[model samples]
Target: MTAPVSDHYSAPRRSALAATVVALVASVTGCAGTRAPGDEPAPTGQALVIGASLELTGQGSALGTQQEHALRILAAKLDVDGVPVGRTRRPVRLELRDNQSDPTLAARQAGELAGDEGIQALVGGTLPETALALEGVARKRKIPFLSLAPGAAVTGSPDDEGYVFKLTPDDADVARRLAEAVAAQKLRRVAVLAAQGSHGDAGAEALPTALKAAGVRLDRTGRLPATGSDFRAAVRRVATGRPDAVLVWATAPDSGAAAKELRRSGYRGAILFDSGAVAEQTLRGTEASAVEGAYAVHPMSLNGSTLTSIAGSALARRDFMYRYLQEYGEYHGFAPYAADALELVAAAARLADSLDRGRIRAFLETQVVEGMAGWYAFSPSRHGGMEADSLAVFVVSQGAWTRIS
Candidate 1:
């Protein structure tokens, strides 16, 4: 995990730091204006501002809200010890923006954040479309970006500036495992229902290949616009095809609508979903009784669940699925992914040395970060780890998502 020396550098004692307030003005937004490579801008009085964008009020609002709460728990732990393996010249401040589930808005926010003079690094985003949209801006601004989720389209084509880094295994690998899960359930006939978003498109394009390799037959496949008030028509269309299994990848687009519609139509086949669509509380509300025995494949680890179970409150990942349950009285959601994502971000920063975007990105691309999951590593040629073809399939039993792995 050693970072390349060229990528990061610590500041040496500066002449400006000899006294009190020595000011430096930076007017650029979206683009960085740094002191001469050698002229370390003596320690400033302000805390280093970390920028984040979450889909707080949009289709993906659930994840956004949970991640924000999870990050708070992480920040609280930064009291004396920073994020694990954490280091910094000053205290860190997290600044968040809401994309409200709009891809364009998410991109715009990232663009503006990159240009902002006060922000140092970028983190947080639950969708890949937004990640791709913000990719260019991160490159243009020379700011370190830790998407800390999944996707290779953006992280694969990492900028020369090495500003892009991620923390999840690639879908290509996830898709393969998902195909296996489908076959294992004896859901030999498959129908694909994709949302009109980045994640959906990727799953749609990838599933066919994965299923075909697994000797699974496809009955039908269709794409749905990411937006919809109801899914009666779409459900009817897929039902008409009589698929043995329905594979849906909703991403941040929200699949609760379609899931509910399927239930109303009395579709009883195993309804397989991408982890992105199998939201905790949202799915509970959908009442997709037809899919009561449905299965889903997600990128998760044993560590998150273990920790949350052990630590009921004080600094558990994503506020502890257990504590959230205690306070809210009936808690449910995928809190581990968000908490784990932040942990990886802080680790990458430490590995990359001085938080230099270029260096950290390079460090991530080259090093294997041992996370709650198995070893996570990335490279230009291979953007994800863990075979996508072998994701963990879980079934809903007794109102809880139970892993079949």
Candidate 2:
């Protein structure tokens, strides 16, 4: 069963909580709400339950764990009493289920959460396939789904994406940033190793176009199951190509394993990874030297200057980082995305001044809010919420992620 839990900010920080709540509510309602017809009234006098299905114990666990932590933090921070909706204090409950990194399980649990649990909105596993699965449930159930993963196909067109939205930037942008890195490094030829799934397929499909734009040649390409751990053969195949750089588009430990293997295979070329591959937990099994000098293209949250610019002030950014570290003990790459997803939902609820799914969805379609990761704006035709400018490239140096332009 998905755990149904509620949390609120520390009692000692009432003033801060009020301020944050005001900001969240105002950010959405300042120019929100053009409701559609045939909307139903929301339930009253009960906890507004939102559901999340996360890959908490499998290949995606490294990032999933961070996502869960962020959910918990935002659930507490934004758990306001008496929101703008008629000055009514409503307790927001987050029900989380572990999908174990399985898309089938994610889809199944998402159905249960919507059909049986009757949650108002859905958040879920950090993969494109999972996003696709949850989107189906959202469409059928007429509830909103917020994805924390990168997948361009998740929102193929505006016509099919009324209730589905994503917090991460599109895969095309990530690939373009990666291509920029290749050009910046002056590498002409590259080998590709990507996971097998929606996220990987999207990246793999976009890479060739991006590479072509950068005048880089794709010499070799290898595909691995998202759950596949063995990369000895794939690494050898890619290494033998002797490309100027090896581009790995995968998640944590798997990509880390590929990086380690690339080094062991004596491939003395540059290594570049997709954003999802560079979290701290993902690099634990691999040696630091294997990752040293390897570059990755990820969101701007990984860089202080870019993050401060989006977050509005140095002090506000510092406060969020301090709170996150204090609560979670360690930071994970997907944490900020998860926080932004939940906070955006809460803000939509406030802006609509009701818990009705139709009203909230309507508000989200025109909402613009500054999240911990970056700015998010949604419209009838745009459901992903982020722009290409949200991405930045980073290099692993001395076992830490350092931003490079």
Candidate 3:
């Protein structure tokens, strides 16, 4: 299957990089500044740099591309002067490095960002493994790291996760929701197909726990390469099980392949996918009937509801979505999450009234803000920053994703 022409996210433009960096400084008013312990003072005459390591040209590019794009968009719409710290605005600069889908490189770049670039905060990591790699750097450097991926590995231990935070729903939470959804429909047997990685492993581990009380049994389990091109063999094996439903936990194009293959096998009672498959564009050219009744567990809804319950109000969400469409030609599943992560950081900086990393980290632990996705609040015990209500079920009806619950 060919990628849609409009799906390609262009590289960052050099000419506007400085201007965009300057725009990222959000304004803060009426805040007193006190330097918090373990906090580093802001650099003089230089922008407050924030570094990001994203998979720019590899298997995870589908998701990372959107993350990078979202950062660029948010940088433009934030503020012109920079974030207000100590009654003065500090110019914010974004320095992005392409990890090319390698976790090692992601970690290496993160160290460089912290040691050499002097970035106060960091964002990126669409893949769970990459996030795990990035997490180490955050802990070692004590820089606030906002991960865009969903996995317990990103925010596992409070001691290890002090500097780490994520905006997306944890895979454990998503797996539970999916299991409950299956159990509600009286489906006792399920075929689980997960990709081979941290995301897949987390889902594989969480599903059974959620289904144990419901008495849903896994009839068969299969694992495929996270970025594998062919899934016919896995689909055939799953179809042979004749389970009540098939749960595919994988990233976009792979999830798309699973749906197509299952339909071709002609044994679908119900086809369900994980959060990564929620992006509507993943199944763009497929026949409506191919996945007509398919379901997905998504972190947030992008449809009809006013979204007033989320941060920034419905108007802000509307404006951001509109701008996203205008800029990218279509909305990617993770774009809003990435944008919201940046917004949350900026909001934290405003609350702290300083560019001090420790201050911002402390502020985030108790700060409650409505973001593009939904309500977000963090605590010492929870670094994932999401709750059970963070996920909702959606179904494919009439060739579109419709929120059913």
Candidate 4:
């Protein structure tokens, strides 16, 4: 059921839905295409259905729940009238399932969703393992998968990953940004405390090269136990060298727990985090004081733009933030990745003029949009969409993430 990869890229023949912020930007000239008069009929009412398998009730619930909220809010907004499809404006619909942070469950749910003829595309996977599991199913079914997880290997090679797309910035990008930040502070030595999974595996592998490039030395590295497990011993091991800083490469609440353990071990050096640690859970209750001064490399969407800018993307982001805060009472900066994913899929549907999985896959490769989260430039040669320029540094200050870079 795999989709055939196109050798040549085609320009999008029409503008994407206005609500999705798909306006052509200056960087991508000649991307907008025109349709011949009377080539297509008038708008027909239908629905663009998307499927999701998230970690709603398990270890990754903190991030997964935020994504769920984002998806719901975006769906409601787009459905106000509908998103522009070929000759029709289609309402967006979601079929969401809880994977419980289990890779096996995620794969099964992906299979079921992909099997449904009504489900046009898939999005979810807040954890690296779950995202990888979903990748397997999406590849087998030849369905387009937009992964919200942080992992370099999630999309592997574009040739083999014709149907898979990563919404998060690459691990190497985050590592490089973090390394440069550490170097800016003149920190010579750093220790790493990574989580026990694929996400941590990526950080562990990328940090050494990035640190070396930034003239920083790697002191030591240790692995944190699974969620709910004690982190004192692991933290103590990495803190033995009295390194100038420690990088906590794991998602919350693990990110916060590791910080707590580091503080308990009497290590007062700087604590750096990858984007996965930007969740609200990292700064809640006991974890707040521990992570108060910690820094993280995340997307610029976290800081958000003021309405004064008046850019379409800025306006779209401001609207999304307003809706998210109004509905959920608070905003988790990381949640917009899901909204971006859904919008990417809708944009593809608009360009392809069809809901066929193969067409969606092809158009998805050609997308270059300013999403709610950040800028994504997908091409036939690149499936990991989030650009490195989209990343920025933020610090946990006053119990909130405040942009510092």
Best by lDDT: 4
Model 3, 109-134: lDDT tens digits are 99998786456788888888888788
lDDT of each: 0.57, 0.72, 0.71, 0.82
TM-score of 4: 0.89
Q: Report the candidate with higher lDDT, 2 versus 4.
A: 4
Cα shift from native, residue 378, model 2 (Å): 1.2
TM-score of every candidate: 0.75, 0.85, 0.84, 0.89
Give lDDT: candidate 2, residue 250: 83
Model 2: runs farther than 4 Å from truth? 1-45, 80-82, 116-118, 153-161, 307-316
TM-score between candidate 2 and the true structure:
0.85
Better of 2 and 3 by TM-score: 2
Worst 10 residues of 1 by lDDT: 21-30
lDDT at residue 192 of model 4 (Cα atoms): 92
Q: For residue 84, what is the lDDT in candidate 4?
A: 68
Q: What TM-score does structure 3 among the candidates reach?
A: 0.84
lDDT of 1 by residue, 1-405 (tens): 110111111243222221111110011100122235674433323344568788778666766676676555544444223321232333446778888866688788888887876676676667776666665577777776666444544436533545665655567666776787777666678888888767777887888998998889988777776465566777778878678878877753356666666768877776777767555543465464544666666644422332112221212333345544554454434444444444444544555544555555565555433333323445665545333322456776665677666
Ranking by lDDT: 4, 2, 3, 1
Tell me model 1's lDDT, rounded to 2 decimals: 0.57
